[model samples]
Target: MRLSLNPLAFGTAFALALCTSAALIGSGPAAACEGRTTLAQSYVGANKDVKAEYVYCANDLRSDVSTSTGAGSDIFARQNDVCGAACTTYCWTPSGGGPDPNDCTVIQDALLYDSENTGPLFSLDPATNTSMIVMTYNTCQTYILDQTNSSLTYCRSDWATLVNYIAFNCQATQNAHGGVCVADDQRWYIQVQHS
Candidate 1:
């Protein structure tokens, strides 16, 4: 007597095996969500030592977001929009512009906190002439108040990071201008009238 295996059964088993292998090998869709848009802008005050760079991620479905400056040996401060979630922001300014003596790297990490509303995270108060960099992970959009121009500037991320981390830098500067200057990662600069 001769026995033959059912074609349907063999096909189903083969498909299941292939899917299991793909998942185990990490070839499946990503578990974390990615940002729909990213934005990075650098602002320098015309008068007084007020310089800052704002980076933002909007509609980010990822778990968290973080970032840092690229160059320069100056003190840096950062804030994010992870309102209720576990978030951490830190900066290590080497005594000068070079690698750390101890071979250490600056780190900004934002972990799982609340997944709902990310943030208006930072604030811009024209009355006080103060501005803050803000970021939001879950929300579809983010904004920063252009106090000098008396207008609202939108911010978002263009790509995604491991933890949905997005960041930029802000340094104080002294110049002279009546309007607001905006700079982005693409190196585009524009002046807005302070209305």
Candidate 2:
């Protein structure tokens, strides 16, 4: 498996933290049944060894629902919108510099925890304050955003790792104004199953 996370490795500290704060999420989706709008639901999360008929519920048929996958904040949220039964699940080392938030997914567990991220690997420059590197089958080699002007060059990993797992390619030329990167036309998408 490309990703292996043994909860034991997180040690007692992380566990204690999770135990102390996961009260809200522990209740899960069942608790929201009071006013839920689910319509003939099958299931939410995916299994490690299963790839059944990936369902697709339309916008008019569903609501913009979400669920938490980790501790209190800044972790990850599963978006269950236009996911066509949409959900993006991810589990890995809590690294600061990784793929774009929107690009990271775990819908097909095999693509994430089962493999070493088989797609365009884009990560913020870990060594610098401003920069992101892109790698894939596509031509865009990098996102050299260390200077005032940097563009997000795209990549297409042949193993079906498309941007948002859908786009063939993309670009977000942005400038670090006041030491913060700014791309007027770029944004991140986060969709996860509330299972």
lDDT of each: 0.22, 0.22
Model 1 C-alpha lDDT per residue in residues 1-195, reported as the tens digit of each score: 899998534533442332221111111111111242224444222221222334332322221111234411122112222122211212122212222111110111121111112422233332333333432322111123332212223222111111122122101111111111222221111211111
Question: How displaced is residue 85 in candidate 2, in Å?
Answer: 19
Which segments of candidate 2 are over 4 A away from where they belong? 1-21, 25-48, 58-117, 120-195
Provide the TM-score for each candidate, comma-separated. Answer: 0.19, 0.18
Clashing residue pairs, backbone N/CA/C < 3 A, model 2: 2-115, 56-84, 78-191, 78-192, 79-191, 79-192, 83-86
- Tens digits of per-residue lDDT, candidate 2, 107-147, equal 32333332344343332221232232212211211111211
**Candidate 1 segments whose C-alpha is farther than 4 A from its true place:** 1-108, 111-122, 132-147, 151-195
The worst-scoring run of ten residues by lDDT in candidate 2 lies at 175-184
